[model samples]
Target: MATGLHAPILDWYAENARDLPWRRPDAGPWAILVSEIMLQQTPVVRVLPVWDEWMRRWPTPAALAAEPPGEAVRHWGRLGYPRRALNLHACARAITAEHGGRVPSSYESLRALPGVGDYTAAAVASFAFGGSHAVLDTNVRRVLARAVRGEEYPPKATTTAERKLAESLLPPLDAPRWAVAVMELGALVCTARAPRCADCPVAAACAWRLAGRPAYQGPERRGQTYAGTDRQCRGRLLAVLREAHGAVPKAALDVVWDDAVQRERALDGLVADGLAEALPDDAYRLPA
Candidate 1:
């Protein structure tokens, strides 16, 4: 099954992969690492512009390390999770100070960087350095769940079984290409909501399709709601700080959200998260 699976998916990817800049030969390990960080929970379309701008502005780890953390957050620009910017900034500093301004090649070294978890570390190592590792991201998880396990969806959280399954399917040679091919297949064909089974290269051999495409029977999956939530309030407050050249008055932040209590709470949360700074004069700004 693993041997049969690799060829068609790699063939399909060769014919259909998107021409993202990060995939280019000249993109380097730094570009691939930056793209991996920015692509977290954000779609490729949104990440493209921000990535291009970031590459243009700070092409290397040392370049970004020299900038203030707040500058990273400011440039983050409505990416939804501003803390990732801080994480990337922290990673830049660490890479510069410890690794001599190079993105680490090994999964263990990459995983030690701030905000880089198991999936991210694996992705950077595999995609950037061509190190063979099981990169079980959401897309790959979904593909494995349906094609191998005959399940409509993977569990809400990764499991040991899932990890072992992913590891088992990894080819001995050209594993990095195989990894990205399966990921692209999941992203384009075996989607979570509406999988185009007809378009999937492995559909004929897919366990789920052979079993009549069973519905997801696991725990209910809930979509995140952002409206009027503390998260929304935090984004509103942070937007004001991101735009301000200097410390913004409390009144400036207060006007973005109507609920004074929620606004204040969100502001406090930002400061606590190192996304914002509070002045003695009651003004606020992005972390310096």
Candidate 2:
């Protein structure tokens, strides 16, 4: 981070940061970890209520670990990647059996847990424990790209240089707060679309602003299509199972999607992904 930009960003964040449940002082490592995982691809508004209810229902790793994975998937709701819920359930059990039912503090330990990766580990270590780790999430990456690298967007995939950039940006002290402040600045001021540069704290030092903000020209950014796709089919099939208490007849699933090939493929995909189970009589339901 530019030395001049540091104070402005931290000061702006102090006044404008969202009062998300996960950011409260009372939220523990488990709550913060859950919020990070759930917030990965979902919007904040969608994640808030679900997180509150989830934390209420399973406050600790042991509480969630005591339940079947099916219960976790069911409770996951429409968070998009329901597989993350399964990973969380597996992670909870690992924490219970290995870390004495507590979220591990080290980046390595958190990364070793199911579905936990470098970004997730760094985020958990920094946000949950106030550790000095480079939290290079999408927002932080974008902020660095525009402000430091003079680019409209970060490289589609993270690079060694990106990690180095993030590490170099860490403040000498209160690195955790600095990391979060930059992340919030990106999320709020330097957004992907409609950035509020005039109000941005570091506008004067931003390389993008100095260079006259340019449009991304690397590759064609394509949006994902969901209608009539396998994902939509999966959602439809899962919706039935999520609402069901017992095995669902094959005929019931048949009505959800018209294309027999795509429907069966989606159902098979769900079972293959461990989001659902097939019974002996060809009926299906969420995994037991």
Residue-level lDDT of model 1, residues 153-207, one tens digit each, is: 9999999999998898889898899999989998889998999998888899999
Model 2: per-residue Cα lDDT at residue 82: 91
Q: What TM-score, over all chains together, does every model reach? A: 0.98, 0.97
Candidate 2 C-alpha lDDT tens digits along 33-147? 9998998878999999889889999999999999989888898898888999999999999999999999999999999988888888998998898888999988999998999
Maximum-TM-score candidate: 1
Candidate 2 local Cα displacement, residue 264, angstroms: 1.3
Native-referenced Cα lDDT, model 1: 0.92
Estimate every model's Cα lDDT from 0 to 1. Answer: 0.92, 0.90
The candidate that wins on lDDT is 1
